[model samples]
Target chain A: MDTIIQGKAYVLGKNIDTDQIIPAEHLVYSLSDPEEVKLYGKYALSGVPPEQGGLPQGNIPFVTEGTFHSDYTIIVAGPNFGCGSSREHAPFALQVAGAKAIVAESYARIFYRNCVDGGFVIPYETSVPLTGVIKTGDELKIDIEANTVTNLETNITFTLNPLGDVFSIVRAGGIFAYARQENLMAQS
Target chain B: MAQTITQKILSRAANRKFVDTGENVWLNVDILLTHDVCGPPTFDIFKQEFGPDAKVWDPEKVVVLPDHYIFTANEHAHRNIDLLRQFASEQSLPNYYDVGTDRYKGVCHVALAEEGFNIPGTVLFGTDSHTCTSGAFGMFGSGIGNTDAAFILGTGKLWEKVPESMKFIFEGDMPEYLCAKDLILQILGDIGTDGATYRAMEFDGEAVYSLPVDERMTLCNMAIEAGGMNGIIAADAVTEAYVKAHSSKPYEIFQSDPDADYHSVYRYNVRELEPVVAKPHSPDNRATVRSMQGTKITKSYIGSCTGGKLTDFMLAAKILKGKQVTVPTNIVPATVLVARALECETWEGVTLKKIFEDAGCSIALPSCAACLGGPADTVGRSADQDVVVSTTNRNFPGRMGSKKAEVYLASPLTAAASAVTGKLTDPREFL
Candidate 1:
């Protein structure tokens, strides 16, 4: 069940607050709709949602929904992602939406773990240059099995940590499927 | 080898006689505390990562409260509180304080000490950075992420980087208008937020000894802005009495050796220090509030975990007994205990809330309402309407909700004066 996401890598700027993660309005009753949560970056995609959401949204968010990397599971951001509040919901919404891994310059200590503890999402660190090297609509091919990221534009490839054996199964879906597979193998 | 409190805790956690730089240590957390904003997230992760029957190490060692969003601005936040309550119900947690529920009240910092949930000489961690406030109780406490916090809940242990020590020896006498809030704000303005990154500040010396436990707590409470593991004032008789009064647990005293290695040492002669402010976008940018005098202020906030102490109210109340706030001001106690303490003994001869109320100042609950920008508090509406004044900690840009609206860092007294006059006014004038 190893997976890799490669496409134009869209860069969401740094310090994206939790309210911007899923927005207080989209939250339906008590249930968090991850499908809709994915729309959080919409303002960034066009620099319109924040203005559309009220405040004059600036170009800083760097939203690129229709751009090449918009569909990629990997998002590279600046330092201190999930900086404000101790909200696990931010990462929950991120993973539940479509992100498989988040590569940031750095992460807020609390939010980073909430992401990992929630599921097997890789949060790696790299130089800030990676943001410019990545372009919207540029397809990045990542091999979940090999733990490598390849830039189609530069033909450069980088290796990342394996999702760990325990997470390899959980990343396939949830713990139920993971435990089911482990149990079936044991029976076999 | 002489043992300091920090060294003792590190050695005990590392299972060694001494610790070296860059050493990995496993330490048992003395207490695990969290607030509403942090509590639910950790619970969700605990449920998924550890399973339902997961055993929380010591229910009695755990303290959880609702502070960040106590009233729940909307339905979603309410559901989040419900989840935390459900988790608490199942775990039989010893110290669970729901908002406005019994005496389990106010800022997380005050509540933890009030219920005797925290003991000196033990290591504690919470989901909030101000958890360092507990270090004033003479124990090592720091803030960590939900991930690390999750492991603490499921495993009761955490791996820590042995923090280097920064010693601050405060000597000399306090001049007329100085207090703990002013001292720490000056420290922040001097060092900036990154000054103590990953280090532990040890407050010692004559002035530190003279400081009451409550004032010392204020010092450690604001240490989070220094970006350190925790700020600790080694235990003395003052600490012992506080611990014995608050908890029945046996206590031990820990101190550092005179020859103990240090990353750095600082000496402050506060006799010459003035009320200072670190301007916006940086907590280290220092300037005297007097220099920024006459700076127009729109909204003034005088309470949060850091600024909201009894001495805080008393100091401001003494000056405000016959005065009024210049602009609309909000003087809030960090917790209900602080509010209640203010009501005790017409101290300096006047109750704080009553004085504030008479002055047309609104004294609110013991919540972190405006500090965290938790609704009803934002600095500016497009730079055109931004307000500026000094507050308790670092003023990183947009830290208080408006990137353009400037935030100035200062002591509670400076803030109180500004609130009264609606402009950046010095406390010296009020006195």
Candidate 2:
């Protein structure tokens, strides 16, 4: 059963780097306690730190703190969702942060597969013009079975297919569950 | 009448057939790679995907490098290393690269290129996205997920949709101290991070002709950082010189036609670029270091698969002579060879290793160690207020340690200068 995250899409218009998605700092940190590592944590506000001058003051609302974190599911990105190191910790953090699936105009192939393998839904090919279609807080439904996303507020229905069987493994709750069911020996 | 290098390679790999635009198809994988952190899971899934007696799809096509766990502070990482060793022995795979006696063989991509595993006219994929780093040799390479990596290991093949190609024509000479690192940073900053997503980046131009293979590699390696498929240069005298110097194995050359189709064209007159930097939290954020030089860095690291080359070492050693690093620095040569080359003092006037170590810069074994903040490398993002300038790609927050930390991207010279001053200063200041 594909779950529908009933919240508006927090959209980033362009140029999303992997560093911002799952920063290198969070890579080893998540191994200790994944729940603590949110994809867009408090640092999203201040451009990451005092050193980087933080984010734009008005953009604080866009940080995952006050509003971005509440019930958001589908992250509609411009393109190239996963572009940096082929670090699996990337998609792992995205899944841990409660991102149900991602709807992008296009996805980095490694990122797409990592999303599917990590039990997070990432679909693309632009079923609809991503530009101007999504607004923050527009409730959306993603039916995993049919591999389609419906923007309830805008009445926009987008078609997509998960990245092959990797989706099935992820849908089963990470690769561990799929491997366990299939008698796969997961590393300790 | 015109076929791009990518179309030609993908077509040949796909049974000598011609491919048109927007066709949903899968192409053959030329090379497959795995590292320490990602290998255990792959072996586990692969073993389950096929029964015990399952022979590998093709042993020669696979490459295993124990880079992630070359050394680790945790026991779990140790156990993973053991498991990888067990997997290698059970399969009788010979291409497996453990931390051998070789010094310069650290990161898989660097080691592969240095040791001549990456050849021209082939398709390559590594579990690491930086696999695109090998594309400097004129090969099609990509980074893939574990599932795809596992599938390739089981069946010795993977699928791909033939991608669009973009032609980058560069003209003029690259300035001194302005190496391939600057070229890549410039491209990433201009095109945006996702600019080349799913497209084959073909590096062509007279300025490109001026770049050495390693510099070209930095360009190709960072291709994936822009969400590109592969970054390649049309084979030329330099490539031929590289192949002749590096390998005795016979290989064929791959080229593109003059009228080859491109999704778009990016023409840069080398005379046009200025020093550039990708601001923190994203790779595409661009500005001149001159614009943002007001900030200071607590740490400056100048070695990785990206910057830890012989020339990189020579350049660093030359600059750091009689100079001291302002921060606690570590110039980790990604491979034993680069480390040894630095140690030998053969190429430069000063011993690079001694200059680095004498200046309180420790030479740690290459293990993608500090790059990910494990053990001795934990960045105090929340703990320390110091910002870091690094030569390694990706300046995501807490990349060095704490979430509150800052990372500034720059060339080796810039990083070396920052290391000396504990601030984001230019190499010219030190010189």
Number of the top candidate by TM-score?
A: 2
| lDDT for each residue of candidate 1 in A1-188, tens digit (9 for 90 to 100) | 45766554546655444445543233222222444344543422231133322112234334344532234466766555554344455565555445666766666544554565445356665554456566544567777667677888788877654445435444745433443455521331
C-alpha lDDT of residue A156 in model 2: 75
Candidate 2 lDDT over residue span B1-431, tens digit each? 57888777777666665776445455566678887767776676676666667767788777888775456556656666677678888888777776544432677888887667777777787888888888888778888766667767766565676788988888888766566777888888878777887788888888888888777887887887677888888777888788778777666677887877899998887777756667776666767777777577677777666776777766666667778887777677777767777878643456777788767776777657666555443322223555777777777665555666667777787777767777666566655
lDDT of each: 0.66, 0.67
What stretches of model 1 exceed 4 Å from their correct place?
A: A1-188, B1-4, B14-16, B376-384, B388-404
List DockQ, one per candidate, in order: 0.17, 0.33
- Give the TM-score comparing model 2 with the true structure, all chains together: 0.82
Q: Which ranges in model 2 have alpha carbons more than 4 Å from their true place?
A: A1-79, A92-99, A116-139, A143-188, B100-104, B346-348, B375-383, B428-431
Residue B399's lDDT within candidate 2 is 58
In model 2 chain A, which range of ten residues has the least summed lDDT? A51-60
Which 10 successive residues of model 2 chain B have the least lDDT summed? B374-383
